[model samples]
Target chain A: MMRIEDILMTLRMFQDENCDVRTVTLGINLMDCADSDLATTCRKLQEKIRRLAGDLVQEGTLVAEEYGIPIVNFRLAITPVAWWAADYGVDGLVRVARALDQVAQEVGVDFVGGFSARVEKGATRADNALIAAIPEALASTERVCGSVNVASTRAGINMDALLAVSRSILDLARRTADTDGFGCAKLVVFANMPDDNPFMAGAVHGGGEPECVINVGVSGPGVVKRAVERLRAGSPDLNLGDLAEEIKCTAYRVTRIGELIGTALAQRLRVPFGIVDLSLAPTPRIGDSVGEILQMMGIGRVGAAGSTAALALLTDAVKKGGAFASSSVGGLSGAFIPVSEDAVLAEAAARGDLPVDKLEAMTSICSVGLDMVCIPGDTSAETLAGVMADECAIGVMNHKTTACRLIPVPGKGPGERAVFGGLFGEAPVQPVRSGGEDFIRFGGRIPAPIHGLRN
Target chain B: MSDNSQDFIIAVMAKDRPGIIAAITQTVFELGGNVTELSQTVMGGYFTLILRATLPAERKESVIKQHLEEDWPDLALAACVRRYSPERLFEPELDTAAYFLTIQGEDRPGLIALITRYLAERQINIEDLYTRTEGDAITLILQIHPQNRQSAEHLRADLQNFGERQGIAIHLLHRDILRATSEVGAIRRMVRQGGCLS
Candidate 1:
């Protein structure tokens, strides 16, 4: 029998602490739908996705209701389009992207990932075409998200692909200039991308996955922050180790909820259950910031002197707790500090306390790199590629997943606010330090580090 | 008196005292009874317990009652005894999911009736219910199982609307989540075993 106190505590976490399942993504493999004719392939792809994920939103709602936990987003992820659609050029890819957007709308999903290319080692003809089509594809579709994997520990960083992605992101920004470069928000450049991440704009159903599976992303930074606060109030003399233990315990509970809900949903859908991504992904809500979790850990402000240490402690503890809670823990299971998505981080950026470099430095220890960051509109494509290269280098060297969803709002300069609204939130454009043009101009692959030569 | 052993359902009620369990168990033991299951709780100034015990078929229910009343007269304990049938030994497995519903509002009459009536009308079973009153505020906690066919979303919406009308705050959550948060080890074990806890 569950104790009354325990029931009340869980209820309070949901009602007051903002504990929620961030997403329930249905990953559908579109590889089998490929055809020599682009139109036929797009049609087959839509039909397959519609058939497999038609009930996704409804089932997700039912599961969320059954658990009394809010599932904020119901999303879809398919296999990377580039590999199977090698014959399709930019125009054909755009058509496929539109079909994906339509299917997402018909199925009532928030976003459809896997309008993607994996060019970590090198770009194939198809990968090159897909990379070129990203700006138009994303700008033309509301729900289609694009990702490009340009680096991996084993394969080294593809600087050539990075340059293309950077230029494409700028084009996407220009195309959606009216929405404060919102099109760029739907695109992510990744390094060592996970096969089972359920979070967007970087989620993709990798080739190794089953035909269809359900992966859940659980988020509860507010709960962790509150737990720390309560622990501190009760035992003021507790050290950092004690506090880290508390965070781990909180993460365990959070991940358990995700697993429970995900299992039930998968069983109902009669699809294979993938993994629960135990990422502390925050929204624009006031109390739901990863930066706040750091603050509760004794940082006076986010981006302070000890922020990286705090983030490292937090990410490590979260992963430890998640690993203990579930056997199939995958994806980027750590804290996400997306600037515009987190109010505190956005505030720190606005106040000039958190610069682009500090945010990049923190990502070395946290989850995902340079997420939801807004840079000045005039930032050059080479500079953008430089940013991507630097962040990708961190991922390659550390053997971790890193991504960039940098938005360069058109006509918006540093100190100006770019509002994407909703979960994308709003943030002041951070100034980018230039002078990396020469480095990015040398557009060739950076060979994999010696550490990657394990085999 | 028969050759087969008999099961007795026993209830004990008394003012809260430390030796009540010892005295009761000792008497049962003396009667050649083996305790099978027992649950006890204290409310207000009184203690209550229910137990299932098996005794030799030669003993009668009245014999145990009379012995308890006569031997523990000074303690002023009340004992009720009944025959426990085999059919009642095993509880049916509950396959449906469990949820915890919490309600809080200003203390008022008919609050419990209103909530219970709503659930009863919908065929939602309340597995365990508890309520406490402090000054003008009343809090209720209920473990509920939605009927197999009932839609949880519909029920949640109805309950939320009802709460709005009645000026009460209601929160509903999965029972497993509560178990996971409060007793992490129990949830871990359940997950590892690939089973749901009742």
Candidate 2:
């Protein structure tokens, strides 16, 4: 006869292993539904997303209950509609965006990523038109998220695309400044963008993926933190290698549960299951932070001397363990160091311990680049362009994916902080490097470098 | 960036010095080879250099390798040169998983031996490693690519028992590295469709 405490302990142990379903992303492939005719495309998109994702919220909740894990959010990733939306002009863009909003509301998904364009080397007529319409589309749509990939490792930096995106991101921020740069929040500019990332305003269905695939994102920052704490409790003799192994073991269990849940969800949804994205994606909550994990790693704080090595270890262990657990573990599967969403990181930024330069350094060893980074409202578009250029350069040169979603909060200057509540947490407005008059001025097209054509 | 191309991996090992890069670079330059990609790190008094140098159609790997050895013989060097076969570039079925497998214990002598033995049995490949001792504890972060079908849980379980016997705590996290995000895919598609995939 087991005591109630023992039962609770077992339950807690399981929860500690992989407690939460990080994300249940319903990928709605809209390519088939898209029409060259603006109104028809909008109508089909609206109808298709609403119908496909309509059961998302309820199904997600039920699945979480069944698995004894909490499903934190139900989201959607649609095909990038910018190319298709160009036919009807800005108004057509507006209509399609509004329709997406309705679909999101009806389906009860929190966010829908991939209202985007890819202009790394250059833009298409459709992509150009979509770029022009981004500000309006983002402003009007309540749930639609937009992303533009303007740089690659081999391609160097696409100055023409970066300059245009800089202005557009500024325009979006300015238009929606009152709403916590809400429009800006909807936009992300990326390098080496992934195709089946389940996280949004960055998620999109890659052409290589199945028609419909359920991708799972697993989150267990607190669990990993707890393991670190326990290891450090009675014994002080443990070294970094031992600590890293503990993290790897913890991540392995977490990833196993995620694979089980994702596979189950895909089976039930009748969709082909995609990879279980093992990204240590965080939220604003205190315990659920990648920074806290770094702190647990005895770095005192993130962005310190041992931060990169620690992250590299943590991230690599996560991949090894996750790869063994699931056959199709794809997407951004490393430990994500998103400063804004992780409370500890945000606090570090707020307190000035973690600077932009440090964050840039951290991204080299970790997955993703400067994400949800907040800059002063008065930050020059040129400086933002430079930041984008630097980050994209890392992506293109390294042959990895990196992105930036800079929110120059209007009237919010440096050292000021804003709390956007929920997942889009508060962030101290980091100051941009001054004096980009030269690089910004020399903004003619930076020709594609000779190395980008690796495929 | 033409499709009619080849890849060669040139690994340079030598004593830590400043001009080693310059000398190697000059050799590539004189040989009409372009240094396309390179990463170098100095550790424990040795400089390790890895480069993916692109050679024009006329110059082959043998010529490039010969130039380095014949010209810079005095620079105590061991070179491992291999041409990049086409298959290595795009084997989609290749396991793309990258993770940091960490092992910690009470500074036991056989901790690494035990962990690596298990990993070896499962055919897991370690990409990078950083290990050190803090007081009496030993920690290692092994960036690994586990073979297909072997679960991280199996390693975690094996390590757990190993740690118990060795009086240490072991942890594992699935660090999924190199898995392209959805955004990268969209960019590739959009670029291809836009006639910019090249």
Candidate 3:
């Protein structure tokens, strides 16, 4: 029999702290489904995805109930659509996206990702067409998500491609303006993107993966926050080192839960088990905020002086603990502070305590960059590209996976709230001191840094 | 670590004091035997121990009981001995997942009776249990095993009803998760090995 105290700790984690398996993404490679005809390609892609993912939701539900751990979302990722649809135009790609969305709904998955393009070097016809289709494809389908990778450590930042993507972000946000530009929330721009990230809107079954795989994302920001609070209460002389150890141990336990559920689901589905993305993806719920953990770690205000150091300590300790817990740890295994998704972070943004500059600084140490941050409606595409360029530079120079998911709520300005509702939450349109029109217009490529020539 | 054919199971109950184990082992040593396995518990100042021992030669149950009574004159003890058989093993846990059911409520008459009856109605077996009361705070920890998944599901619904009607705060969790958190090597058993308690 297990110790009763240990049993209660795990119980409290599940019961009050909202610890859960954030997502179980079923990645199905769709390279073989491609055909010369667009209709035939979409039909083949839908058939393959449906056949592979038909049991995904049902099996995931069964496993969750069996273990008493809630699996928040059952999602699907496929090979990047631009890889095989080189000749398909924007309309054809939109049709393909609708097919993916339909099959995802048929299988009862919450979202389908990889309506995406990779243009770290330059954009092909297919890549440009996919970017053009993203605004319509995402606005028409409720469950489809899109992503574009415009930078890498080795290939540097593709400024021209990012400019096109900046325009697409505006178009997508404008299409869903009534919902606080929610369509843009489902699209991400990444540098050094992971192939097996289970988190949307960046998940992709990129090259060099199996035919079918299962990657799990586990999150428990609330659990770690409660733990830190308990340690502070229990010790009069507790230091930052002690607090970090507490977070590490808590992360190890939660990551173990993720690996357990993911491996079992993969075995039942008879697919290869991929990796567990131990990113602390928080919800809009109060207690489940990464900002709460940072506050409990002694940062009085989220965007205050010590924000980046606190975030650096958090992400590094989490990676260390999760890496020890599971040998198959991959993807963006760091702490996430997505504004609006985390209640405290959103509140800080609304109060003007968390400015975009401070957020950008924090992202240099955290998981993703400028996540779920809403900007003014009239922010130009050039400025949007500028925002993405600065964030992508951090990623390329640091050799980390960084991304930006900026939502420009049409007709909303600074100090006005834009509500996306549900898990997307609501936040004020953070003011952007926009400039750089000339510099952004002169778009070419930012050459790779000297350190990037590791090969 | 010797497994002999002539194995006997013994039970001893006495007052809470030291030297109880030494006396029992001393008597068993006189019979030229080795103690194989044992479980011991103490409740309300009384101690109970059950052990299995292997002997080179088979001995009567009466002989061991009488020898312990005459050998330790100052200690009053009640003892029972019987032949040990592998086929007669009594496994309290069912062939399904084990769960931890925790209960916290006010101290009242018939509370244990009510809880045990609840478990009995659902056909759940308690593999281990302990209760503590300190300054009006009572904590009851129960390790229960249901016969199958359907009964486990029923127990969950019943548990919610019991908690609500009885004004209690209760939580139920799988035992494997506790092991996964506490034991470093146990997660492999739960994941790669399916459901084994290593």
Candidate 4:
């Protein structure tokens, strides 16, 4: 005879799948917060962020408790600051970043990103200044995060910007080598950057977002992974469809928890509710990799046969479950393959089995593109330009968000390993196969592909 | 020609062209061999193929290798004759796990080897990986499973410290790949004109 508790437990097994909350990102719009005077700009930026985000941490905690979910991190994503700092130059930009940091501390957010610019096709003087200031800005400010968009599906990749950004990342690291380029931790060079992403360093209030909206990022890679393991243990005969069904069910529960937390947080914060991003955002830990999930599906390696199909299934299942959970589900709601953020992915990178090209291929199906990859220090800027071009083409052609967060480790090459501590794992600094400086000298915007002009 | 217990495994790499499959399959058929398993892929203009076949008792691995190499010099062929593992013939248990890992750093060679060697030593298995390059910057992913029952978070922190010294960002976490099917039961009851599962 089964006790009532046992029966209920069996029926409620899915509830455990929904235990994680993806992100509690506080959105701060910086467009109206800047001033001509550097001091005024900094003060305004600080006041605005502090005023808006002051209650964010407490509210997020209350909501997490109410929904019985773990809100992993409290973060802030502001409007891209490059545009506002166009007239102020690097010095002025640094001051704004300092103010941003102060506000982040006051609000108790883990990270405050959005010192960014959208330049998928080309860049202006302002964009250049911001990109140039990356190393210093990140080193100078503890919380200010920066991301520069050098590629987009419609406009292709800006080779010039990519080359420059690559150099900027390297310079930033070298300047702060002692800090493990922790400043680089605050930077993400993107293509097809999302507007509603609630994950920091990359999260920014998209152009399409509401002025003040509360969004959520839900994570449950552990829940789905456990279900797969259980299914395989219980029944060897289960097919791929059976596996997919389990994934969807797990995702549904996880999505519901995220919605519950987000809704509760918004109500308490007295802000308009926004989308819930159901991204399998992983931390620097084992057993939490999206790539490991694909491996579990029987593919010998990450880039091998049936990889895309598996990713598509996972992405779709997550979206389906999340959509059903909330009417306002939006943002990059899919499995994330950020390399530096997942330990399993980092290990595969250290092995020869995974390559940068394979990572690019997987991005076609995953939510984001080739991210947190390392290359040889001597790699010519042109090679970086080419990679950016290829990734941007994928995003524009497929009409999806793609990004590149490449690190040019000083004094390293293919086959040599570098270990970046804490959340950023170890990586094999893959050497570039190409090294043509001539291509980068072309220096003109690649015309937006005809497809982008389409509706 | 009456060998019932002999089998041959063929591994071939060649430039992809027309009739490659037909040529191989036809060769086996004409030679009175039964093709049991086959897998092929075309990448970077080269075609890679693997085949498992049962051959007549009189045939040997050397004979097949000799004949194939002599007949088709254009096709780089390698053959090994051995007893087949029955487990390889059937799908293994469908157990699956998913995870994410992050590694950041100054560029170096053999970083993958260093990390994977650790996993291999600990009985952890790697599945898939994704990496991107912008100039010298690199970020990569490795999906893996641990054979031991250690805490995933503990492993991640250790790797993180390792990465910090080398300038690599390391983050590892497991992915939940499936959910329980309680809701499916509700659907079954609602559609009870002989439910879909039944």
- Most DockQ-accurate candidate: 3
Model 4's alpha-carbon lDDT is 0.70
* Pairs in steric clash, model 3: none
Model 4 C-alpha lDDT per residue in residues B107-132, reported as the tens digit of each score: 56887788778666655666655555
lDDT of 3 by residue, A1-455 (tens): 66667877898899899999999999999999989998899889989988899999999987887778999999999999999887889888989989999999999998999999999999999999999999999999999999999999999999999999999999998999889899999999999999999999999999999999999999999999999999999998988899889999999999989988888788889898899989999899889999999999999888888889999999998998998898889989999888989889999998889999999999999988999999998899999999999999999999998999999989999999888888888888998877787888998899988999997
Pairwise lDDT winner, candidates 3 and 4: 3
Could you tell which candidate, 1 or 2, scores higher by TM-score? 1
lDDT of 2: 0.73
Query: Which residues of candidate 4, in runs, are more than 4 Å off?
Result: A1-18, A179-182, B1-198
**Cα-based RMSD of the predictions, in order?**
2.6, 19.8, 2.3, 22.6
Best by TM-score: 3
Higher-scoring candidate on lDDT, 2 or 3: 3
Candidate 2 colliding pairs, count: 62
What tens digits encode model 4's per-residue C-alpha lDDT throughout A1-455? 11223222322333444346757887767788767788888888788877788889987775454223467788888888887878778777777777888888888987888889888777888888888878788888877788888777678777778778877887886776664444665688777788888876788876866667787887867667777887889998999889888888777766655655665577677776677788887767666677777777676576666777888888888888777655767777888887767777767777766688778888888887777777776666677767766777788777788776777666777887667776667667776678556777687666666887877
lDDT of 1 by residue, B31-123 (tens): 988898999988998998999998987788888888876788767889999888766432323455667889988989888998999887776
**For model 3, what is the C-alpha lDDT against the true structure?**
0.88
DockQ: the better of candidates 1 and 4: 1
Where does candidate 3 stray beyond 4 Å? Answer: B1-4, B42-46, B88-95, B186-188, B195-198
Worst 10 residues of 4 chain A by lDDT: A1-10
Could you tell me which 10 consecutive residues in candidate 2 chain B have the lowest summed lDDT?
A: B176-185
lDDT for residue B189 in candidate 3, whole number 0-100: 53
True contacts kept of each: 0.45, 0.00, 0.53, 0.00
